[model samples]
Target: MDAYKKAGVDINAGYKLVDDIKNLSNNKDLGSFGGLFPLSLGAYKNPVLVSGTDGVGTKLLIAIKANLHKTIGIDLVAMCVNDVLAQGAKPLFFLDYLGVGHLDNEKAKDILAGVVEGVSQAQAKLVGGETAEMPDMYTHGHYDLAGFAVGIADQAKLLSKANPREGDVLLGLASNGLHSNGFSLVRDILFKQNTYSLNDRLAGCNRDLKDELLRPTKIYVKSVLPLVEQGTVASIAHITGGGLPENVTRILPDNLSAVFDYGSWQVPAIMKDLQKIGHLSFDDLLHTFNLGLGMVLAVHSGDADEVQSQLQAAGEIVSRVGRLTSGDKQVIIRKDQQ
Candidate 1:
């Protein structure tokens, strides 16, 4: 045996996995030092390259524990692509990084299959990625995933340049359960403190607890990009880590505040179950999980109905959640009225 293989880093295994990844993603250039992408500038006179990178977070722990490896890569791609999409960009290509202690070919292939599915969902190509097998760096069966997505947008149509004004209507797109955030708390509440197994089903949830927990994050590219091109969407927020309050407030101007009509959109049952069982406060829930809305858009009141119509026509569940108001920079969840 080679000294390196004896020491735990198997070069042949890494080489074989690379070939398998290339085959899985159907990209022959994946094993190259750098991923190649051809830029076609004909689409926009003033094109801007938008890039975003994110990881699957501790959600991977759950995936590993549940032995569900196929869809976690979707969460990885969604996390990065949606952020770029929030800026009104069209995803062009994606790259992923995997770090593992040992290179298990089947497990690696399963992960890559999900990445391919995610790239397909985003309408992006999997150009390149890295898989590092470092013995002792990770547990024998555990690996981590991170993804980077590059997109293109006309400079004139960037969502960040859209100035959100007071009275602008807030439109929310439905989420697919807890989409890759607040899983640390979820694991603690469900497995640590409560000792619930992955097979255990909580009240109001139809599937086993594993299914709910491992649901891939929703990708919002196809639904929102058309609105962005039409200039109907003023600003967009990808609700992730900090939930609605923090993510929405990022796109808001200093003089305006976002006031959401709480209950206007139905919060997912899984979120409510976590709150009830975990004894989590509404404020905590607001700051942690998405609570159903994955992406929020700020549009002019006149364009609100049309934008909602367009998003619905694109097969998204839309809601007129709330509107911007003249106030300090903050998010206000009003339960009194819709």
Candidate 2:
């Protein structure tokens, strides 16, 4: 061991991680100080590269508190890839950055495994990444994850912002419970204010709080990418920190608004339970959490049924949640079910 190893850095463990990631990504040449991806411009006639980078917010605290390191990486990957997918891009490759106070070989590998799994799930290659071991930077057993994804879309095939029009139908894709957004509030309400334990179980929830909260953010790549490629989707919204109101409004043109039937689709029991326990207003719930929908899309009225059929065939729970109406940019949630 060298002086670096004596000073809390394990050189061999770093090398072991590099080797493991290299094997996982199948980029044997990644050890060359920088990662490389070979793209044949010949494959695309005028391509636009789309890039996105995102981190799993304080939701990471739940994973750390519960000592569950496996799925945060998946959330990390989903956060990035899904954003890129919104623009109709096919993810080509992904890279990750992990920073830690001290290197624990087994734990590090366990965490990275989810990244590898996420990349695979996105049908993208994990081309490169960096794992930094800094003793003073992070506290013991503390780490942070950031992911970057690069993808390509043909210029003519992009999911442009202007595509949505009045009379278009909005499709709501089901979310797997709190998919890595507003978790700081979630922790504050459940764990801090309410004093709930990780093992605590609430009504209408089949799993413990830890299991429910740590459920990985869903990756929409495999489900929605096909629609993007086929040009069946007019626009898309990846529901994250802004929830449905903020995210859905982003893709809408100024002349249009989305009007949703509140009771058209079932809000996940966990989210409803959170609302009841926290006494969160409907506005807060719409803007702070996904409720039950993860990705909402705009499809032409005629194409809506076919798109829903295709999405369902691709194994997604699809709901025609709303429609585009002529108005200033807004989201209207009818009060019938609230």
What is the C-alpha lDDT profile of model 1 across 213-301, one tens digit per residue?
99999999888888888888899999999999999989988889999999999899999999999999999899998989999999999
Worst 10 residues of 2 by lDDT: 24-33
Q: Lowest lDDT 10-mer window, candidate 1?
A: 156-165
For model 1, the superposed segments whose C-alpha errors exceed 4 Å read none
User: Residue 217 CA error for candidate 2 (Å)?
Assistant: 0.9
Assess the local accuracy of residue 278 in candidate 2 as a C-alpha lDDT between 0 and 100.
93
- TM-score per prediction, in order, is 0.97, 0.96
Q: What is the TM-score (0 to 1) of candidate 1?
A: 0.97
lDDT of each: 0.92, 0.89
Local error of candidate 1 at 170, Å?
0.7
lDDT, residue 98, candidate 1: 94
Query: Using lDDT as the measure, which candidate wins?
Result: 1
